[model samples]
Target: MTLDVDEIERLYAYPATERPWVRTNFVSTLDGAATGTDGRSGTLGGDTDTRVFALLRSLSDVIVVGAGTARDEAYADYEVDTDLRGRLGLSPIPAMALISRRLDIPQHLLVADNLVVTTADADPARLATLRESVEVIAVGDGEIDWPDVLTIFADRGWTRVLCEGGPSLHGELVAHDLVDELCLTIAPILAAGGAPRISHGAHTVDQQMRLAHAIEADGGLLTRWVRDRDR
Candidate 1:
């Protein structure tokens, strides 16, 4: 049951709030693996997930992604549909916010709206080079202070935040109480490899989530889970 653009928007509209509303979107296999054998999450999703993926990007001002995942998933493509964003009245392209501790980003992606979110613990020489090409955001001296990052995003009017995770980053966001929702698509594949789950970190917090809705489409289960604000 593939949905048209309007229905997709109706299903996953960002909450109307002043602060940053964080939502991490991912597609996983039935076996709980977030990727297929080829080491890419894209292989686990189908047409419906692709459509929703586009809508998620079309609705956000910036895409927060781990530098590793950005490289593994070829996010240098920016994965944005500019025309779709235009018709939906969103920014022509969501800024690609690549978080890297070492400041190891591809040279070609070091232009335009590619924001390098890192820390003071990174390599100084590399940071100098990256700063020359794009804006560099360092919110933490030892680690990434996600709360401050959110504040910066809000200050820039990029309140609708979409986190495309490589697990650790998503886990940090969850542990920080910064995530508002998770839009997960369960692909019907039993990937029995060692791919990590959707979110993991050195530390974790147990926050209750409400299963907002689940829709079956394109041989996958599209689910929306919102953080239970009362919890």
Candidate 2:
């Protein structure tokens, strides 16, 4: 079945507020592999996944992602629909935020408008070089503090935060119990052997999620979930 754009928008809608909200979106194989043999999650998505992905992007105020994922995905500047922006009451086109500990980011992604969330102890010279172009926010001294990430977003009035991940970031968010919603696309394929799950980490955090809804299309399944806050 085909999912209508309006229907999909309504399904993924966030509350109309300037409060910090985090939504992590990912596509994985049926066998729980986030990446295929190609070592990238892009291979796991199909046409419907692309539509839903764009829909989610149009709905968000800013796109937050890990630097590794940004590099691997070859992220570029994006133009959002002005009509959608007006309809959603979004202040601007979705801004891109990259969270990095190592500070090894793609030069192309260092566009002036983008935000780079990093730590204080990161390479000062490199950071100084990047400061010439992009806006950099330092959260912690050694590692990225997720709480500070939220604060920065809130201060910027970026209530709608969409995280398109490389799993490690998702894992960190999940560990901190900060993720509010998860949108997962289950592709109908088994990528067996040595592949990571949607969230990867040595530590474990068991968070229950309520299945808000699931839509099947293009031989794949897209599921929306909200954290079971009451649990």
Among the numbered candidates, top lDDT falls to 1
lDDT of 2 at 169: 88
* Alpha carbon lDDT of each predicted model: 0.87, 0.86
TM-score, candidate 2, is 0.95
TM-score against truth, every candidate: 0.94, 0.95
Record all residue pairs in model 1 with backbone atoms less than 3 Å apart, i.e. clashing.
Answer: none
What is the C-alpha lDDT profile of model 2 across 1-231, one tens digit per residue? 887888888888886555688899999999999998888888898888888888888988789999988987788877666787897678667888988977788988888778899998888998898888899988787778888878878897888999998799899888888889999999999889888888987698789898988889889898989985532
Q: Give model 1's TM-score versus the native structure.
A: 0.94
Model 1 lDDT, full chain set: 0.87
Clash statistics: count for each candidate: 0, 0
